[model samples]
Target: MTRDRQYSFRKVTLDDLPLLAAWQSAPHVRQWWESAEPYSAADLADPKAARWIVSTAGRPFAFMQDYTVHGWEDHHFAGLPKGSRGIDQYIGDPEMTGRGHGPAFISARMNALFEAGAPVIATDPHPENALAIAVYKKLGFEPAGPPEMTQWGLILPMLARR
Candidate 1:
């Protein structure tokens, strides 16, 4: 999808910890993310995940990450092909919520992965997250299957093939 606002991503670093913690704690974010605990250095150090701080014109506003689904411990994405990448993200700024930035940022990230030769990319949002599901569908993601309860939450699997 085309976006009037141009956005980019930067590799998430230690310097972003405070902002990450704050965003994770925001009521708007926590409502769905449900994480009250702060992100430890170890979380960002995860080898299977590539984390990024999404920005527009060099100003940070969101957090996003993509990880090899198969590399995750007992991931629900076993049905997906090997080399499949899964994404998770949140708009850190409350003011940015409801804007089209989510889809734009996701599109940019997915395009990067496709350019890098990834076979496919996927995302799992809570089944009840209609807003997220809608945005993902608008970006060409289709439901892979019904919702399943996992340690993270009840998720509706979706995939976008390159």
Candidate 2:
């Protein structure tokens, strides 16, 4: 975590799907993600969601997405304060993991969201996903509730408030 990292998030486009698809199929990402399928037309067009290609020093290395917490019905984070948002991400390049990039990029995006007036930011990692939980905690997220079954599957809800 000592090395300085400069991260950037660029909006995802259709052309990036092949790269994202490859990442989604990686063993590390597949271990916890529900589906490895790249974005469908509907997903890409969803007005409430934002998908991004995460990069460091101009090299694309990860995928990320965020959305309005209450944008969907039955959403786990809907109970959060109005203007809250939710985030999910993965480092596509195997070499990028365990090197502090997760916290660095997530913090950058989270801070941007907060500065843009979001009241809270939420995340839900599978209960067994210790790596993700650790990263979230490192980024100031606290467990908001116990595990719950949502459309996304079982998750341990966590939150960080601005």
Candidate 3:
């Protein structure tokens, strides 16, 4: 396991769009994310989703969100058990990528979800995203199903059971 680091999460707000946009523009983020689109007004209005900015030592460096797997009728993760949650995130700052924050913050967040009664925490990393897959695997996530396509794109559905 990667060494744990202290990270803080803050709910995203209208005031954060500019900073998020800048992070999305980074080539490292754009390579897989393609676009930096984090949230829309509708996304913020939805009680099912939680959007956040991840920071360390008081400086934000990543974006993360978790939502109900069954929130969308046709969503890929809808088949998961009710109350199961799905998460997606990116280390917007490339500088933070190789430093272990991904697994550390993500594991911390998933642990919280488990403690809150989540039966399983799901993740759908792109099939070719080895780095992301590694991070998930290191945190005990395993393939829940084969790779498949959805409205967002292709994904390898994975889950960490409680």
Candidate 4:
């Protein structure tokens, strides 16, 4: 698909569930995604979960999930200032891997969140997810703290005036 036709960051909807579920279960794709349990159509249809489908040319390719950090209250990071937001994403299609879509999708999502008044965004990945860590760093996300036993913490650089 042409770069111009890619849907880097679009809100996900119920209609895209079937495609999303398939991608999530793909062997290659499942390695990085934590949700391995069966996901029902009703789960996707639920509005309480704020998620987005990343795609190109109107075809769904990945999933992006975000929520208020305070609401989940997970103690993944201790040094980050309070009021930070968390962002998580996974490329649903294994065939699309290593084709240069991750960074573009992340940039688009970050821009959208920043514009929406989010001062900070955070993502945690297993240390072995080197490819994803590389992509995160390439997108200007700096390591926030030392890597925990299983996960590494990363934070996007604060917006700076040009």
Of 1 and 3, the candidate ahead on TM-score is 3
Checking candidate 3 for backbone clashes, the offending pairs are none
Best by TM-score: 2
List model 4 lDDT by residue over 1-162, tens digit each.
235645656666666667777877888777767666544667655543467888786667778876555554454643345545567788877777777777788777777777777677777776677887888777777776666653333333221110
Q: How does each model score on lDDT?
A: 0.87, 0.91, 0.88, 0.66
Better of 2 and 3 by TM-score: 2
State how far residue 88 of model 2 sits from its true place (Å): 0.4
Candidate 2 lDDT (Cα, whole model)?
0.91
Highest lDDT scorer: 2
Can you write out model 1's per-residue Cα lDDT over 1-162, one digit (the tens) per residue?
355778888888888888988999898898788776656689778888899999997779999999998885688985677788999999999988777788888998999988887788989999989999999999889998899888788899999998
For model 1, where is the 10-residue window of minimal lDDT? 1-10
TM-score, one value per model: 0.92, 0.96, 0.93, 0.76
> Where does the lowest 10-residue lDDT sum fall in candidate 4?
153-162
Model 3, residue 159: distance off in Å is: 0.8
Better of 1 and 3 by lDDT: 3
For candidate 2, list the clashing residue pairs, or say none.
Answer: none
Which regions in candidate 3 have their CA more than 4 angstroms from the true location? Answer: 1-4
lDDT of 3 by residue, 9-98 (tens): 899988888888888899888877856675678878799899999999898999999999888899888887889999988888888888
Which regions of candidate 4 are displaced past 4 Å? 1-5, 38-49, 77-83, 149-162
Local error of candidate 2 at residue 111 (angstroms):
0.5
* Model with the higher TM-score, candidate 2 or 4: 2
lDDT of 2 by residue, 61-151 (tens): 9888999989988798888888999999999999998888888889999999999999999999999999999999988999987898888
Ranking by TM-score: 2, 3, 1, 4
